[model samples]
Target: MELKEYMNFVFPGLILKPSLYYQWDTRIHFELAKGLYQFKSEIDELNDEYFNRVYDQTTTLFNEIFSHNDELFLVTNVYKHKGDIKRNKKIKVYNHYINNKNIRFQLKEETLPYMFDDDDADEYYTSQFSLKCQKQDIRYPVLLKAICNQDFPPLRPRFNNRGISNYPDLFFINIKKNIIFYIYDDRGCEVIASDIEAIRPIYEKYNEWIDEYCREDTEQLFK
Candidate 1:
């Protein structure tokens, strides 16, 4: 599907909002599921072992939730979330890499009038790549880790300021599956799917590691 068409399905009416907003949208919506990772210390992020596990589980979830041959779009804002144009050093480098790879992207300026005032629309230098469910491709894990830790290049795993790793936002989407997975600040993640059965099993499979608040929020959402 064209990017416009796919995006319309995900964020109907050109309403660019977070997964939380989509969960409540009646026109195009999904069953909400949440997961959390156990941290050893308040100052610590996911250790190597659990980090790899999260990557593994996430990739597995992607593969299982959608068909092997289905088209998947790994979409995210490449913008560094800073105002000073000169300070966009990291995403600038990453943007160069993206251009070299010939990824399809667009520059978006979105404003939520109801939530905010003063015409301060957030600008997003968004990049969207068509992907598949193959585990052999190194892109899946690397990008997933980047989204998790918010690291650019995503090659070496590490945290940024206050452990708030990487970019403005990131999303995993499959139009056919009617699902969108959103990860935030390496903290946790939530998936919204129209068909509850599509994600229920995976959530249950990782229940022990899933954050209780996430679980409760999802439960409350559907109830």
Candidate 2:
């Protein structure tokens, strides 16, 4: 199963968002899962347990996926609420590259617009992970990097300051086909993350598909 199908299996009744204003290049969306209604009744250790378990499960799944392939990497921007919402740790694991071999993962921190003309500090943000496939020539991720010396309209600049944030570059080369995968959490981190089990077989299948068709250049793309 692909992204859409896996989303349904992990957390059903959620759909992708068409567009969002004042947001980054996030073209993804979703809502809370119907299960785990117990949290609604009462918020206690169970809530914390649920969140931790879900996060651990997700991270483990991704760890497995990345471990299996030398050409894939995981970039996680962990957010912590310590009097203020701050990025606790920015991790780039396994492989972080734009060459033909690897695909970099990304998840942007987004905020909701309130009545006031300011980014709401109180509003909890959602999580959306993306996989951007690009050529080796591109120096930076597409979301922040300029294409042909021109930026995509209304650029959501990352500054890429300190090299802390790493995303996929959008600069494509005609030699091979490049793509992006936006798996979103529309519930604003309300529930759990994605299903690795559902994604494994399909992801393997996708690689097989690419191997069968996009030939020769595949090795150059990875290492």
Candidate 3:
């Protein structure tokens, strides 16, 4: 089958939200700040435990699926502003999983304009009375929440939320086709099969309930 046809057949009506941090700015920045303050420090601790468990499981799963040697790295992106000099954004710190020496090529990039606000001056001033001007664009925390709340097993998910927020959970990477497949936990009900074609049938069979679960749209689904 053609690649397009295969993707459509396998992933019909999939509404992929381009990595969360793309074009991130003031609006997303504030939301992330609110989420962090509301969620608290404990969230970071929980996310650490979550990553450890997921990484261990992913290693085992990869080994079972493929016999050849392969490397896995946790990747995340951080955005920095031109001025207001802080060497690294806060979001980069939360992605501690990649700190290890063993993992290779763990980081990737996507860019967004710094401190650019879409709203007119009057509208922005009215909406955010406190700050003279919005600066910086980081989006890690909110993206982490979205990944964690999803159903996929603790596999390290990618993030585009450049270093504007402190999401302690998400990670990102590019993979080789020959070395094991990519298994994505898309929220709670769906699992996306990437690269490895042989297991698509199995994934589809196991995750069949996701369609019904997604359709129900119950509040409980998120929890």
RMSD of each: 6.7, 17.1, 13.9
What is the C-alpha lDDT profile of model 1 across 1-223, one tens digit per residue?
A: 6556776665555433355434443221222122334454676554455566667666665566556555555454433323445333333323422322433233232322222222543532333233322222225555566566654334354333321123446666666766666666445565666566656665566555455545565555444
Query: Which prediction has the highest lDDT against the true structure?
Result: 1
Per-candidate clashes, comma-separated = 3, 6, 15
Q: How do these models rank on lDDT, best leading? A: 1, 3, 2
What is the Cα-based lDDT of residue 168 in candidate 3?
26
Best by TM-score: 1
TM-scores of the candidates are 0.57, 0.25, 0.34
What lDDT does model 3 reach? 0.30
Superior candidate under lDDT, 1 versus 3: 1
Clashing pairs in 1: 36-211, 150-165, 150-166
Model 3, stretches more than 4 Å misplaced? 1-68, 79-84, 87-95, 99-163, 166-174, 178-205, 208-223
